[model samples]
Target: MIQDKFKRWIAGAAAVSCFMGAISAGAAASSNKLPFNDIAGSFAKDAIVRLYNKEILSGTTESTFSPKKSVTRAEFVIILDRVLGIEPVHSAINPFKDVSEKAWYYDAVTAAVQVGLADGTGAHTFEPAKAVTRQEAAVLLVRALNQTGINGSTSAYVDEEEIASWADSAVGAVRTLGLMSGDENDQFRPSDGMSRQEMAAVIDRVLQNVKWAAALNKQSNATRIQMGWQYGQTTAQFEQSVFQAKVTTLSPRWFFFDPNGVVADNADQSLVTWASKNKRQIWAMVGNRSNQEVTHQNLSNVTYRGKVVSQLTSYVQKYGLKGLNIDFENLAPADRASMTAFITELSTQLHKIGAVVSVCVSPDLGSDWTDGFDYQALGAVADYIVMMAYDEHWSTSPKAGSVSSMPYVNNAVTTLLKVVSAKKVILALPYYNRDWTIAKDGSVIASELTLVEQDSLVRKRALRPTWDAAVQQYTVSYQLNTLKHQIWVEDGRSLAAKYKTVMDHNLAGLAYWYMGGASPDIYTSLSNAERFYGLSFD
Candidate 1:
């Protein structure tokens, strides 16, 4: 089936996303030797020896490496430059007065400064000889790696209150990257100068990090390895954005209106031609969302089911379509056997002509609305079985909670994987959020929120949004008039956590619900998600 070839391509993409280590692959191995007499039995001896072999660390003299010496700002910058393979671009106009052209490390310092790896202490003074603080080294390493969008707070450290205002995120990033650790007292001494031995160990960890991030990173091929949902009416909205490049497959709500097997008004026929020209797989959606009587009637009668399949087959041939998304929702429980028969029949007919079949079902946890779905039967026939993996809390919900809490989603996926093939399942995620307003009497009211609107509301209400690690969603609470409002917002962090569910289960990919709702930054988050998850999907 060429699944092996596809997996190999994905592996290659993942390898490229990881940080390339200081050592080049295929290079001859060097002999490990202790440069300093005092480091023979030291805890950092191995790290010191490795960096020395890479020429990233050096001795104070011919016979002894200064294992106890404090690393200066200039020395750290030079080490970072070498380890990251940053070529020092020689510029004539010096940014700092203290750094002279004749200085031995002038090129390294200038290169570091140009790329924002290092900066002056104050008043244009580049304190080259000053000892590099733990915080300073963290910032330098983060910059050297070109990592961005890292959010951190002092609360993560015991002495976090001591961390400088500017170094909070830097310290957080370094800690998250596993390059830095706390002391015996469980304190991150941000102001303390880093010793030469400690520097060596950190750099050694950075070298190992290259392998770690690469190993976990899986590059996704949007065409075969990823999927997303679209509203046919807003095809023009997402067709031109960077978000389009992040998704491999598009399932537009193309045909979900009448029970007579007719396509919906929301269906955009032109998307079929556009998808063909762009080499994208367009799966035309077909189903009934709320009208249970129509769905029951269509599935119960053999004559009507045949007609429905006939109409869909015609649409596929006429449009040059890639596949079909069966989104029959809210059907009666009595239609269980009928539902399975319909899917089996549709798959059999569709596969004859090479068009794929994907069935979207509500999250199954013994709920009445989802009891009729025969996951085992559908999973066997359908090419892809999508789990509408959200709606823990809807607009008319009683309590305010996460729309798709990570724990709930994880449990649902875990259970589904037991009955379905992981390779054929897709987890559908919500791109929007719900805001709940609570009156003093404990009554709750909710409204839908786009990510952009959520951010604006956070600012307008002057509320601090706190990340709930358990759920992977953000929570903000505030008082307006006599009512207390609480919003559990969804953004990049929550989305990445949701995507992890798919990866953890080795599922086909994810399907985002309705485009044109998320902010522009969500696109960057999705594109650069490899960095966050340390994954690669080619």
Candidate 2:
């Protein structure tokens, strides 16, 4: 649902709204502008008024924005850099034979070069005085966002459609941010000239988006600016955060931003502080765990889902954290392609702000797996893979076995390695167990319970655990006041054994289930396991 709305936002709805009818042959409405305006002669006065009201694009003079005059390349960079907060990595200024140290456009041009906004010809000259063309301006604006787009081609091209096809991503990116728009006829005049009015209008739209994005990024950078981050994050990021630190072996559900199962306010601020102090890497949960679960749907679901995604991203960035973790699990069989599409779109959004996407998965045997765990497609974009290797056994099973046995762990690791790089797999371990009440009916619904709770129930009912070596599980099928109860518990020994399986398989790192259990040394034991094998999550 979130992905569908995001797709719609980028597809054409936004562009159509912004790009209105052409005022005349050469004077099309600048959707980038507010009611104030940007075009000169006629549009300049109103555009200046709107700019003044919004307090964004300013003028060279006290009263005039000079919309008719051709905007210089230097002025363009400054507008993007200062008001829009378009960051430019500073590099040594040494280009353009005509451009001197005393030139007006020198600093802006230099900054632009440092950020890959523009490149000079082999002549080693940056014509700062040269006017920026419409196509060239599009390339510059898109590059500023660091969007490789969907096609993964360079910004420059001779043909327009090929450019948009490659730029379907950049166009979508800018549009999502409400930065730029096309014509009512669905035409993006890439090669046209950027007039003073057009540049001002574009700058205004971009600045508006940049302010919101800047706040989101500020939170992300607080954690690790060196690694990078982004806004409009992902669904997996939402899942990981919502369910953060509350993960368990029998997790069929997860929460976000709520520490200890409560929704948080200003999650970005709270999480950033927590992450910086604890030296933790934060991950976002992406995709749709509930998008297709409903019987009937309306447009409201999409909007609500998009709200969740946007809010989640803002929350993550506000806190100094790691990257994102996608776990849009339990998908229907038919929505596999849609799931893939979500990841592709989602990764594009997260990567722009310098965040890494780590995907979670169940073992994919090429059959019977749900749509959310598309190993091949997910492997292509995510920074890593988290193989959730638990729950091979349930209370309802006719037989008993280790929920995550050596064979179960090994098989999952091996098959996933076929689809993704070994370095990216974070093998998740189960730290709990299952309990069952048996009768003449053969089996019943699995009682998903914690190990400690299971032990308490056993002590209360005078039930003793019987070790079953065949499957490395403990089964107690004893009569409790004329009724029989069976339980399986994963103790320290079983956990250690699973850790050994992780080592034997040489997985990336061992992740534990249910950190909130507050087991005396559960996390410590897992940490020791990693250290024992000379494997560091760091």
Candidate 3:
């Protein structure tokens, strides 16, 4: 009975594939009516046509598509290899006895196994010609998405009992992510072979869920900048840092805008000299001191805005500076247009002098605080847009929590990527944590703790922090002198998670909140992540 049903499904899919191939071939030449003919009414028509257009998948022939054909294990692996651009391991000795190095699918099979996406059927044997099962496809698809270990519920499916123990989580994950689904009977036929149309549908869904399409299109080619912000640090202090070697840019808090629209010049020549000697680009930070009135007054006036732009361009040329990091904050939302114009002028003048401009923006949480930033406009004008992704729990907050939680930062990045290109986005991480003291009267007093200070407090008080998976940080709570203290620690573990986010999304690069707050192990974690992701500081 199952075999008959599968055969009927395959016949329908084959017709659809054939129709899609004919349409796509015609589409390449000129516009035609109903590009897809027979499969126009098929549910998989859109997905098949989309993949066919991109040439990610093809029909069996120019006129006929064998969509009813069951995709072989090796064939599906090749498809995934193309989408992921998986590098093949060039080895003389093939791991699978059946997969020959001379075969067309050898590279795909080897690359799949190398990335832990697939394995042999038996010891040294990969049944490459065998049809891959639906459940097996789910596992491979989940791995290809780099989303393994995601817990999902498979109880909704009628055939949950048939799901193998090993593939249960993967099946659940793909289902929950809407990358795959059961048949009309709501049964996930675990052992059934996947048809070509089904595979195309799954692949199309995967592309929609991730950044693969964008990466392939070459929308962003900005060199990843590993930047570190420095404030109130001496030249010796900056030189003694361990992360300096891996840093590509240094943004020191040198310039500020006062109330009268006057530019305060605190440019450090010695720091610039040190940065030049170390072959690092110096993008000095120009801040507005978080004064809304001053920001509105300066940016709203054309003369003042030009003066500011002229001064910055002159400074960039005079000091041989690479660029400027605009750190304007607490601006009125009404100044959104003016803010964009100000940056547009600044970026234009700076670029003419062979200099770059990066604007700092707070995360858009649909709040007035972030209303001043027009992300898309800023992204277009500036060389880069830096996300100051921290301070979830402010210094004077009524509640005590992490300075920057994992979900908060992830949401921030995801939100920013919607407007700005990933190639021009830089995620700035915090090297400091906040310690909150809850008094008896319910008042919360928080103090900022640098990485070194946090470490000392942990050891001095003999406190052990357990991992908080929810926030992706280590947390510990203790009582000291009638006050309850809670700390969310920022160490290698937490920082590594952030690094993975940056790499996974293929962001421009990462930056630290301040150079003076980082420890030796932090740099090690960053170095390991860069190596793992094949990223370079250069």
Candidate 4:
């Protein structure tokens, strides 16, 4: 009997009134300046006034709201249609037998039916004049918002047992979201008719929730501005380099693994304070030191994962951090699923506190070292995916070349694009270079050089640097201490070329490996509006 009643309520509630011409007709006939006399000091007055101003609801007859009167099914449907800005869909035949072709709500009902917002009562009867029950209202509003309530064991109402099974989930969803509430005694009275004033309050809450959700989505899609901070860098050292970088976001290497879940290093507590004062966002990076054993021991266990998530959440709340950058690298191939699971769990916890998640992943085509990173799954959970597109030619490489060569970067980016969205991918650039010493016995040794050192070495040694167009970096070779030395330099020209690829791909943004090593000219070139994606960081 209860199920049958719920079915009838849904069928009748879903039947929409013809809304085609009612909106403009109501608009022309009503004015927000015309206030309701009875609701002057009522609790729902503010909500009623707000809806009236938005042209979503009107008084029963211009100056009277009839606040205590039950709202009819057709009236509730029309209010929802107006507030949701659902345009009317004209139909030659009405879906419900009781609905008349000439009725003012005829088009509104058709519009609601078209969007699946409301339906007919029986096989063909709409029963348009029936008063809307609280549960029916909850179901209609949840459907209009494109959500289905998640079934749960517990209910938000004290009289949960009285709610029809079909409407239980909708009731809970509406209540949890603060879109709808119980009466003074905390009784839902799901089957009871909803009054005009109660309906007004519900609509107001829905409008506010929709607007807030849109703002959060916009923030999630905004372009990222990321800069890496080297571990152990002093407050003064980080700040000095940051002044030159002129970035809006920072990822300080401040958190790492410890026997006690995770440990945070302030590096400089003042740096975090300074970042907040300057309106900069900090995504505190948590690394596993690329240790396979450490990652497995911590992330694979359910208890350990929970503990780490709790610690990270507490840290973020304490410091008012904007985001988390998970950099747990060098995991065993078997730990792939575990790593993805950890990220999923961490993201869920952090998102509850309104913080973003970014995952730093190594670039790979099909290499074993990067096979452990489930790119697709991580991309789904994280707000951004940082592709460390450097070290193509590492310090241990037999032959020295650009750390991130053009060919290597192009291939890595193209492959990653196949898995992740361009909007969520951040391309990391090398801000320094490698210095290689060639042995006389036809062997090579490599070391890193800052941008300033690259220039000094070239001029002081009178070594004429030649541009390697294929690789897109400057290269030079000279003798030092009886052994020949070769240098691959990353400067303004090389940085600009790489940045162009970022623009060509329409990537989210650029990131630097570390702050201190780059030339000042690199910043000058990046700030140019004409050449570099029209960016003016200053």
* Candidate of highest TM-score: 1
lDDT of 2 by residue, 1-538 (tens): 2223223222322222121111221222243443323334453455445544444444443333456666656656655444323332221224355555455445445444433345553345655556765555665666655444423223333343744443456655555545555666555565555677777667655535644345423321111011112222343452343244322211112233222212234234444444445454556344443445531121124443344445545544554334566665456666566556555654666676666666677876555454445787888877677787887875457764456665777788888888777666777766566766666666554677655565556556654444444544445556655656566555543455566665665555555554433243333333323332332111
lDDT of each: 0.70, 0.49, 0.75, 0.71
Over 4 Å off in model 4, which ranges? 1-224, 264-267, 529-538
Q: Which window of 10 residues has the lowest lDDT sum in candidate 3?
A: 1-10
Each prediction's TM-score versus the true structure: 0.65, 0.45, 0.60, 0.57
How much does each candidate deviate from the true structure in C-alpha RMSD?
12.6, 25.7, 16.1, 23.4
lDDT tens digits by residue: candidate 1, 108-208? 67555543456778634688878899999988877666554665555757898998988888898887777887888878999999998899899888767
User: Per-residue lDDT of 376-430 in model 4, one digit per residue for the tens?
Assistant: 8899888889888888878888886778877888887888899899999988888
How far in Å is the alpha carbon of 238 misplaced in model 2? 17
Model 1 segments beyond 4 Å from truth?
1-201, 204-224, 241-245, 260-267, 531-538
- Candidate 2 yields a Cα-based lDDT of 0.49
Say which prediction, candidate 2 or candidate 4, comes out ahead on TM-score.
Answer: 4
Identify the leading candidate in terms of lDDT: 3
Error of 4 at 498 (Å): 1.0
